[model samples]
Target: MHELSIVMNIIDIATEQVQQAHARKVDSIELEIGTMAGVEMDALDFSWSAAVRNTVLSDAERVVDRVPAIARCGNCGLEFRVSEPFMPCPACDNVLVEYLQGKELRVKSLVVS
Candidate 1:
Protein backbone atom coordinates (compact mmCIF):
# COMPACT_ATOMS: atom_id res chain seq x y z
CA MET A 1 0.00 0.00 0.00
CA HIS A 2 1.06 3.59 -0.60
CA GLU A 3 0.35 4.27 3.05
CA LEU A 4 3.62 2.54 3.88
CA SER A 5 5.49 5.04 1.77
CA ILE A 6 3.53 7.82 3.32
CA VAL A 7 4.42 6.62 6.80
CA MET A 8 8.05 6.27 5.83
CA ASN A 9 8.02 9.85 4.58
CA ILE A 10 6.51 11.02 7.81
CA ILE A 11 9.26 9.27 9.75
CA ASP A 12 11.86 10.90 7.58
CA ILE A 13 10.34 14.27 8.23
CA ALA A 14 10.14 13.67 11.96
CA THR A 15 13.72 12.44 12.09
CA GLU A 16 14.95 15.52 10.26
CA GLN A 17 12.99 17.83 12.49
CA VAL A 18 14.28 16.14 15.63
CA GLN A 19 17.86 16.37 14.46
CA GLN A 20 17.45 19.98 13.35
CA ALA A 21 16.02 21.01 16.69
CA HIS A 22 18.50 18.87 18.64
CA ALA A 23 15.62 17.26 20.45
CA ARG A 24 15.71 13.95 22.24
CA LYS A 25 12.37 12.70 21.01
CA VAL A 26 8.92 13.60 19.85
CA ASP A 27 5.99 13.81 22.25
CA SER A 28 3.20 14.25 19.74
CA ILE A 29 2.45 14.91 16.10
CA GLU A 30 -0.57 16.42 14.34
CA LEU A 31 -1.50 15.60 10.79
CA GLU A 32 -4.05 17.08 8.40
CA ILE A 33 -5.41 14.54 5.92
CA GLY A 34 -8.26 15.24 3.57
CA THR A 35 -11.07 12.94 2.56
CA MET A 36 -9.78 12.85 -1.00
CA ALA A 37 -6.11 12.50 -0.15
CA GLY A 38 -6.13 8.90 -1.43
CA VAL A 39 -4.94 7.49 1.89
CA GLU A 40 -6.61 4.67 3.77
CA MET A 41 -6.67 5.34 7.52
CA ASP A 42 -6.51 1.65 8.40
CA ALA A 43 -3.55 1.10 6.12
CA LEU A 44 -1.83 4.18 7.45
CA ASP A 45 -2.27 2.99 11.00
CA PHE A 46 -0.87 -0.42 10.18
CA SER A 47 2.06 1.05 8.31
CA TRP A 48 2.80 3.51 11.11
CA SER A 49 3.31 0.70 13.60
CA ALA A 50 5.90 -0.90 11.38
CA ALA A 51 7.55 2.20 9.92
CA VAL A 52 8.21 4.08 13.17
CA ARG A 53 10.43 1.49 14.79
CA ASN A 54 13.53 3.07 16.35
CA THR A 55 12.49 6.47 14.99
CA VAL A 56 11.73 9.75 16.70
CA LEU A 57 8.00 9.19 16.31
CA SER A 58 8.04 5.61 17.60
CA ASP A 59 6.22 6.64 20.76
CA ALA A 60 4.76 9.93 19.66
CA GLU A 61 1.05 10.49 20.03
CA ARG A 62 -0.46 10.77 16.57
CA VAL A 63 -3.45 12.98 15.90
CA VAL A 64 -5.07 13.23 12.52
CA ASP A 65 -7.49 15.93 11.47
CA ARG A 66 -9.77 14.73 8.71
CA VAL A 67 -10.57 17.54 6.32
CA PRO A 68 -13.83 17.36 4.43
CA ALA A 69 -13.94 18.12 0.78
CA ILE A 70 -15.62 21.33 -0.37
CA ALA A 71 -16.41 22.48 -3.85
CA ARG A 72 -17.73 25.59 -5.56
CA CYS A 73 -19.92 25.59 -8.61
CA GLY A 74 -18.41 27.33 -11.60
CA ASN A 75 -21.78 28.41 -12.91
CA CYS A 76 -23.68 29.35 -9.75
CA GLY A 77 -20.75 29.98 -7.37
CA LEU A 78 -22.52 27.88 -4.78
CA GLU A 79 -20.35 26.17 -2.23
CA PHE A 80 -21.14 22.71 -1.00
CA ARG A 81 -19.56 19.70 0.68
CA VAL A 82 -18.38 17.01 -1.68
CA SER A 83 -17.43 13.41 -1.01
CA GLU A 84 -16.09 12.59 -4.43
CA PRO A 85 -14.64 14.36 -7.38
CA PHE A 86 -16.61 15.90 -10.28
CA MET A 87 -19.82 16.18 -8.32
CA PRO A 88 -22.54 18.36 -9.74
CA CYS A 89 -23.62 21.41 -7.83
CA PRO A 90 -26.89 20.95 -6.02
CA ALA A 91 -28.12 24.41 -6.74
CA CYS A 92 -27.13 24.89 -10.36
CA ASP A 93 -26.61 21.28 -11.38
CA ASN A 94 -23.34 22.27 -12.97
CA VAL A 95 -20.67 19.65 -13.50
CA LEU A 96 -17.91 22.25 -13.80
CA VAL A 97 -16.69 22.97 -10.33
CA GLU A 98 -13.61 24.09 -8.49
CA TYR A 99 -12.34 22.35 -5.41
CA LEU A 100 -12.00 24.68 -2.47
CA GLN A 101 -10.37 22.24 -0.12
CA GLY A 102 -9.58 18.56 0.49
CA LYS A 103 -6.84 16.53 -1.24
CA GLU A 104 -4.39 17.51 1.48
CA LEU A 105 -1.79 15.47 3.34
CA ARG A 106 0.54 17.39 5.58
CA VAL A 107 2.08 17.41 9.00
CA LYS A 108 0.49 20.28 10.87
CA SER A 109 2.40 20.37 14.14
CA LEU A 110 4.87 18.51 16.33
CA VAL A 111 5.65 18.61 20.02
CA VAL A 112 9.19 17.56 20.76
CA SER A 113 11.49 17.52 23.69
Candidate 2:
Protein backbone atom coordinates (compact mmCIF):
# COMPACT_ATOMS: atom_id res chain seq x y z
CA MET A 1 0.00 0.00 0.00
CA HIS A 2 1.00 3.63 -0.48
CA GLU A 3 0.60 4.06 3.25
CA LEU A 4 4.00 2.47 3.83
CA SER A 5 5.63 5.05 1.64
CA ILE A 6 3.68 7.82 3.27
CA VAL A 7 4.66 6.64 6.75
CA MET A 8 8.26 6.28 5.70
CA ASN A 9 8.23 9.79 4.37
CA ILE A 10 6.86 11.05 7.65
CA ILE A 11 9.48 9.09 9.57
CA ASP A 12 12.15 10.64 7.43
CA ILE A 13 10.84 14.09 8.19
CA ALA A 14 10.62 13.36 11.92
CA THR A 15 14.11 11.92 11.94
CA GLU A 16 15.49 15.01 10.33
CA GLN A 17 13.68 17.32 12.70
CA VAL A 18 14.72 15.37 15.77
CA GLN A 19 18.32 15.31 14.64
CA GLN A 20 18.29 19.00 13.92
CA ALA A 21 16.82 19.67 17.34
CA HIS A 22 19.55 17.56 18.95
CA ALA A 23 17.03 15.23 20.51
CA ARG A 24 17.33 11.50 20.92
CA LYS A 25 13.63 10.96 21.50
CA VAL A 26 10.34 12.49 20.54
CA ASP A 27 7.49 13.17 22.96
CA SER A 28 4.77 13.78 20.46
CA ILE A 29 4.06 14.79 16.89
CA GLU A 30 1.20 16.74 15.40
CA LEU A 31 0.17 16.23 11.83
CA GLU A 32 -2.29 17.98 9.56
CA ILE A 33 -3.61 15.66 6.92
CA GLY A 34 -6.47 16.71 4.75
CA THR A 35 -9.48 14.55 3.97
CA MET A 36 -8.52 14.69 0.32
CA ALA A 37 -4.92 13.77 0.90
CA GLY A 38 -5.59 10.23 -0.32
CA VAL A 39 -4.44 8.64 2.90
CA GLU A 40 -6.02 5.57 4.39
CA MET A 41 -6.19 5.74 8.17
CA ASP A 42 -6.20 2.01 8.71
CA ALA A 43 -3.18 1.47 6.47
CA LEU A 44 -1.34 4.37 7.99
CA ASP A 45 -1.86 2.98 11.48
CA PHE A 46 -0.53 -0.40 10.51
CA SER A 47 2.46 1.12 8.80
CA TRP A 48 3.18 3.48 11.68
CA SER A 49 3.51 0.66 14.18
CA ALA A 50 6.16 -1.02 12.10
CA ALA A 51 7.94 2.11 10.92
CA VAL A 52 8.50 3.64 14.35
CA ARG A 53 10.45 0.75 15.83
CA ASN A 54 13.77 1.86 17.32
CA THR A 55 13.31 5.34 15.88
CA VAL A 56 13.02 8.72 17.52
CA LEU A 57 9.25 8.48 17.30
CA SER A 58 9.11 5.00 18.79
CA ASP A 59 7.46 6.21 21.95
CA ALA A 60 6.02 9.40 20.59
CA GLU A 61 2.32 10.08 20.63
CA ARG A 62 0.96 10.81 17.18
CA VAL A 63 -1.88 13.30 16.81
CA VAL A 64 -3.55 14.00 13.53
CA ASP A 65 -5.94 16.79 12.59
CA ARG A 66 -8.22 15.90 9.75
CA VAL A 67 -8.93 18.93 7.65
CA PRO A 68 -12.10 19.04 5.66
CA ALA A 69 -11.88 19.85 2.00
CA ILE A 70 -13.30 23.24 1.13
CA ALA A 71 -13.57 24.60 -2.36
CA ARG A 72 -14.95 27.56 -4.19
CA CYS A 73 -16.62 27.30 -7.51
CA GLY A 74 -15.03 29.41 -10.20
CA ASN A 75 -18.18 29.68 -12.24
CA CYS A 76 -20.69 30.44 -9.51
CA GLY A 77 -18.35 31.77 -6.81
CA LEU A 78 -19.85 29.35 -4.37
CA GLU A 79 -17.93 28.03 -1.40
CA PHE A 80 -18.72 24.59 -0.08
CA ARG A 81 -17.28 21.48 1.51
CA VAL A 82 -15.98 18.78 -0.74
CA SER A 83 -15.46 15.08 -0.09
CA GLU A 84 -13.04 14.35 -2.90
CA PRO A 85 -10.71 16.17 -5.22
CA PHE A 86 -12.85 15.63 -8.24
CA MET A 87 -15.98 16.93 -6.62
CA PRO A 88 -18.00 19.32 -8.69
CA CYS A 89 -19.51 22.54 -7.53
CA PRO A 90 -22.97 21.88 -6.13
CA ALA A 91 -24.18 25.36 -6.88
CA CYS A 92 -23.65 25.35 -10.64
CA ASP A 93 -22.23 21.90 -11.33
CA ASN A 94 -19.09 23.54 -12.64
CA VAL A 95 -15.88 21.57 -12.98
CA LEU A 96 -13.72 24.64 -12.54
CA VAL A 97 -13.10 25.23 -8.86
CA GLU A 98 -10.57 26.70 -6.53
CA TYR A 99 -9.50 24.65 -3.57
CA LEU A 100 -9.46 26.63 -0.37
CA GLN A 101 -8.09 23.79 1.75
CA GLY A 102 -8.10 20.05 2.38
CA LYS A 103 -5.06 19.01 0.37
CA GLU A 104 -2.52 19.39 3.14
CA LEU A 105 -0.09 16.78 4.41
CA ARG A 106 2.48 18.16 6.75
CA VAL A 107 3.95 18.05 10.24
CA LYS A 108 2.48 20.85 12.28
CA SER A 109 4.55 20.49 15.45
CA LEU A 110 6.77 18.17 17.41
CA VAL A 111 7.81 17.79 21.03
CA VAL A 112 11.36 16.62 21.35
CA SER A 113 13.18 15.35 24.37
Candidate 3:
Protein backbone atom coordinates (compact mmCIF):
# COMPACT_ATOMS: atom_id res chain seq x y z
CA MET A 1 0.00 0.00 0.00
CA HIS A 2 1.07 3.60 -0.56
CA GLU A 3 0.19 4.20 3.06
CA LEU A 4 3.59 2.84 3.99
CA SER A 5 5.24 5.53 1.94
CA ILE A 6 3.11 8.12 3.67
CA VAL A 7 4.14 6.71 7.03
CA MET A 8 7.76 6.78 5.97
CA ASN A 9 7.43 10.40 4.93
CA ILE A 10 5.94 11.19 8.32
CA ILE A 11 8.82 9.39 9.97
CA ASP A 12 11.31 11.45 7.95
CA ILE A 13 9.62 14.72 8.83
CA ALA A 14 9.28 13.90 12.51
CA THR A 15 12.83 12.72 12.71
CA GLU A 16 14.07 15.89 11.13
CA GLN A 17 12.02 18.04 13.42
CA VAL A 18 13.13 16.14 16.48
CA GLN A 19 16.73 16.40 15.49
CA GLN A 20 16.45 20.06 14.68
CA ALA A 21 14.98 20.74 18.09
CA HIS A 22 17.76 18.76 19.76
CA ALA A 23 15.27 16.20 20.99
CA ARG A 24 15.96 12.52 21.30
CA LYS A 25 12.48 11.30 20.51
CA VAL A 26 9.02 12.44 19.76
CA ASP A 27 6.47 12.25 22.55
CA SER A 28 3.42 12.79 20.43
CA ILE A 29 2.40 13.75 16.91
CA GLU A 30 -0.82 15.35 15.73
CA LEU A 31 -1.91 14.72 12.18
CA GLU A 32 -4.69 16.26 10.17
CA ILE A 33 -5.91 13.74 7.63
CA GLY A 34 -8.96 14.62 5.62
CA THR A 35 -11.55 12.05 4.62
CA MET A 36 -11.07 12.97 0.98
CA ALA A 37 -7.31 12.37 1.22
CA GLY A 38 -7.92 8.70 0.37
CA VAL A 39 -5.89 7.40 3.27
CA GLU A 40 -7.12 4.22 4.91
CA MET A 41 -6.74 4.57 8.67
CA ASP A 42 -6.34 0.85 9.39
CA ALA A 43 -3.72 0.41 6.70
CA LEU A 44 -1.93 3.54 7.88
CA ASP A 45 -1.84 2.31 11.45
CA PHE A 46 -0.48 -1.07 10.39
CA SER A 47 2.28 0.57 8.37
CA TRP A 48 3.07 3.06 11.13
CA SER A 49 4.31 0.42 13.51
CA ALA A 50 6.72 -0.93 10.97
CA ALA A 51 7.87 2.41 9.62
CA VAL A 52 8.76 3.82 13.01
CA ARG A 53 10.76 0.84 14.14
CA ASN A 54 13.98 1.96 15.87
CA THR A 55 13.31 5.50 14.74
CA VAL A 56 12.72 8.63 16.78
CA LEU A 57 9.01 8.07 16.48
CA SER A 58 9.14 4.51 17.70
CA ASP A 59 7.35 5.37 20.91
CA ALA A 60 5.53 8.42 19.70
CA GLU A 61 1.81 8.72 20.19
CA ARG A 62 -0.02 9.36 16.96
CA VAL A 63 -3.19 11.41 16.96
CA VAL A 64 -5.12 11.77 13.72
CA ASP A 65 -7.81 14.40 13.49
CA ARG A 66 -10.37 13.41 10.91
CA VAL A 67 -11.54 16.28 8.79
CA PRO A 68 -14.98 16.03 7.23
CA ALA A 69 -15.15 16.74 3.54
CA ILE A 70 -16.99 19.88 2.52
CA ALA A 71 -17.84 21.20 -0.89
CA ARG A 72 -19.45 24.28 -2.33
CA CYS A 73 -21.49 24.25 -5.47
CA GLY A 74 -20.10 26.51 -8.16
CA ASN A 75 -23.52 27.23 -9.59
CA CYS A 76 -25.57 27.86 -6.45
CA GLY A 77 -22.87 28.83 -3.98
CA LEU A 78 -24.33 26.31 -1.56
CA GLU A 79 -21.98 24.55 0.79
CA PHE A 80 -22.48 21.12 2.27
CA ARG A 81 -20.71 18.13 3.69
CA VAL A 82 -19.56 15.64 1.12
CA SER A 83 -19.69 11.95 1.93
CA GLU A 84 -18.53 10.79 -1.47
CA PRO A 85 -16.77 12.06 -4.53
CA PHE A 86 -18.66 13.99 -7.22
CA MET A 87 -21.72 14.52 -5.03
CA PRO A 88 -24.38 16.60 -6.66
CA CYS A 89 -25.26 19.84 -4.99
CA PRO A 90 -28.49 19.74 -3.01
CA ALA A 91 -29.54 23.20 -4.02
CA CYS A 92 -28.70 23.38 -7.73
CA ASP A 93 -27.95 19.72 -8.49
CA ASN A 94 -24.60 20.85 -9.82
CA VAL A 95 -21.89 18.24 -9.96
CA LEU A 96 -19.21 20.86 -10.28
CA VAL A 97 -17.95 22.07 -6.92
CA GLU A 98 -14.95 23.39 -5.16
CA TYR A 99 -13.61 21.74 -2.08
CA LEU A 100 -13.43 23.96 0.95
CA GLN A 101 -11.68 21.38 3.09
CA GLY A 102 -11.22 17.62 3.65
CA LYS A 103 -8.36 17.39 1.18
CA GLU A 104 -5.85 18.04 3.96
CA LEU A 105 -2.97 15.70 4.66
CA ARG A 106 -0.43 17.22 6.98
CA VAL A 107 1.31 16.91 10.29
CA LYS A 108 -0.18 19.59 12.47
CA SER A 109 2.11 19.42 15.49
CA LEU A 110 4.62 17.45 17.43
CA VAL A 111 5.71 17.23 21.05
CA VAL A 112 9.26 16.15 21.49
CA SER A 113 11.55 15.90 24.46
Candidate 4:
Protein backbone atom coordinates (compact mmCIF):
# COMPACT_ATOMS: atom_id res chain seq x y z
CA MET A 1 0.00 0.00 0.00
CA HIS A 2 1.09 3.59 -0.51
CA GLU A 3 0.75 4.14 3.21
CA LEU A 4 3.88 2.06 3.70
CA SER A 5 5.84 4.35 1.45
CA ILE A 6 4.40 7.39 3.12
CA VAL A 7 5.33 6.05 6.52
CA MET A 8 8.83 5.37 5.35
CA ASN A 9 9.14 8.94 4.16
CA ILE A 10 7.86 10.22 7.46
CA ILE A 11 10.41 8.12 9.32
CA ASP A 12 13.20 9.34 7.11
CA ILE A 13 12.32 12.96 7.74
CA ALA A 14 11.79 12.41 11.45
CA THR A 15 15.09 10.62 11.72
CA GLU A 16 16.87 13.48 10.03
CA GLN A 17 15.21 15.95 12.33
CA VAL A 18 16.17 13.89 15.38
CA GLN A 19 19.77 13.63 14.32
CA GLN A 20 19.97 17.32 13.53
CA ALA A 21 18.58 18.13 16.93
CA HIS A 22 20.98 15.68 18.60
CA ALA A 23 18.19 14.05 20.47
CA ARG A 24 18.90 10.82 22.32
CA LYS A 25 15.43 9.48 21.75
CA VAL A 26 12.21 10.31 20.01
CA ASP A 27 9.18 10.14 22.25
CA SER A 28 6.48 10.86 19.75
CA ILE A 29 5.66 12.32 16.36
CA GLU A 30 2.53 14.33 15.81
CA LEU A 31 0.92 14.46 12.40
CA GLU A 32 -1.86 16.68 11.19
CA ILE A 33 -4.03 14.75 8.73
CA GLY A 34 -6.77 16.45 6.81
CA THR A 35 -10.04 14.75 6.00
CA MET A 36 -9.30 15.07 2.32
CA ALA A 37 -5.72 13.81 2.59
CA GLY A 38 -7.02 10.34 1.65
CA VAL A 39 -4.91 8.58 4.23
CA GLU A 40 -6.19 5.74 6.34
CA MET A 41 -5.28 6.39 9.94
CA ASP A 42 -5.05 2.75 10.97
CA ALA A 43 -3.01 1.82 7.94
CA LEU A 44 -0.71 4.77 8.39
CA ASP A 45 -0.13 3.93 12.02
CA PHE A 46 0.50 0.30 11.27
CA SER A 47 2.90 1.20 8.51
CA TRP A 48 4.64 3.72 10.71
CA SER A 49 5.21 1.10 13.37
CA ALA A 50 6.62 -1.29 10.83
CA ALA A 51 8.72 1.37 9.17
CA VAL A 52 10.38 2.40 12.42
CA ARG A 53 10.79 -1.10 13.74
CA ASN A 54 14.57 -1.25 13.33
CA THR A 55 15.31 2.45 13.43
CA VAL A 56 16.24 4.81 16.22
CA LEU A 57 12.59 5.77 16.50
CA SER A 58 11.56 2.21 17.23
CA ASP A 59 10.02 3.29 20.48
CA ALA A 60 8.53 6.45 19.17
CA GLU A 61 4.78 6.92 19.32
CA ARG A 62 2.76 8.13 16.36
CA VAL A 63 -0.06 10.58 16.98
CA VAL A 64 -2.38 11.70 14.24
CA ASP A 65 -4.50 14.80 14.58
CA ARG A 66 -7.49 14.53 12.26
CA VAL A 67 -8.53 17.76 10.55
CA PRO A 68 -11.93 18.28 9.02
CA ALA A 69 -12.50 19.51 5.51
CA ILE A 70 -13.81 23.06 5.66
CA ALA A 71 -14.82 25.48 2.96
CA ARG A 72 -16.60 28.79 2.49
CA CYS A 73 -19.38 29.31 -0.01
CA GLY A 74 -18.65 32.00 -2.52
CA ASN A 75 -22.28 32.90 -2.96
CA CYS A 76 -23.42 32.98 0.63
CA GLY A 77 -20.11 33.31 2.50
CA LEU A 78 -21.12 30.41 4.69
CA GLU A 79 -18.48 28.09 6.07
CA PHE A 80 -19.01 24.42 6.67
CA ARG A 81 -17.23 21.14 7.28
CA VAL A 82 -17.52 18.28 4.88
CA SER A 83 -16.56 14.64 5.14
CA GLU A 84 -16.36 14.13 1.43
CA PRO A 85 -14.94 16.01 -1.47
CA PHE A 86 -16.89 18.22 -3.89
CA MET A 87 -19.54 18.92 -1.31
CA PRO A 88 -22.11 21.50 -2.30
CA CYS A 89 -22.81 24.50 -0.11
CA PRO A 90 -25.81 23.87 2.12
CA ALA A 91 -26.98 27.46 2.37
CA CYS A 92 -26.85 28.66 -1.20
CA ASP A 93 -26.32 25.34 -3.00
CA ASN A 94 -23.24 26.88 -4.52
CA VAL A 95 -20.31 24.80 -5.72
CA LEU A 96 -17.83 27.64 -6.02
CA VAL A 97 -16.76 27.65 -2.40
CA GLU A 98 -13.13 28.24 -1.56
CA TYR A 99 -11.44 25.66 0.58
CA LEU A 100 -9.88 27.12 3.68
CA GLN A 101 -8.48 23.93 5.15
CA GLY A 102 -8.17 20.21 4.40
CA LYS A 103 -6.11 18.06 2.02
CA GLU A 104 -3.13 18.86 4.24
CA LEU A 105 -0.77 16.38 5.77
CA ARG A 106 2.13 17.71 7.81
CA VAL A 107 4.25 17.17 10.83
CA LYS A 108 2.94 19.41 13.56
CA SER A 109 5.24 18.57 16.47
CA LEU A 110 7.91 16.18 17.68
CA VAL A 111 8.49 15.10 21.23
CA VAL A 112 12.08 14.10 21.80
CA SER A 113 14.48 13.67 24.63
Whose lDDT is greatest here? 3
Per-model C-alpha lDDT, please?
0.92, 0.91, 0.94, 0.84
Span of 10 residues, lowest total lDDT, candidate 1: 83-92
Model 1 misplaced stretches (Cα beyond 4 Å)? none
lDDT of 2 by residue, 1-113 (tens): 99899888888999999899898888999999988888988999999999899988899999999999999999989999997667899978999998898889899999998
Error of 3 at 52 (Å): 0.8
Candidate 2, run of 10 with poorest lDDT: 83-92
User: Candidate 2, residue 17: CA error in Å?
Assistant: 1.3
lDDT of 3 by residue, 13-109 (tens): 9989998999999999999999999899999999998889999999999999999999999999999999787689988889999999998999999
| Clashing residue pairs, backbone N/CA/C < 3 A, model 3 | none
RMSD, one per candidate, in order? 1.2, 1.2, 0.8, 1.5
Q: What TM-score does structure 2 among the candidates reach?
A: 0.93
Task: Give every collision pair in model 2.
Answer: none
List, residue by residue over 22-74, the lDDT tens digit for candidate 1.
99899999999988889999999999999898989989999999999999899
Model 1 clashing residue pairs (backbone): none
Per-prediction TM-score: 0.94, 0.93, 0.96, 0.88
Which candidate, 1 or 3, has the higher lDDT? Answer: 3
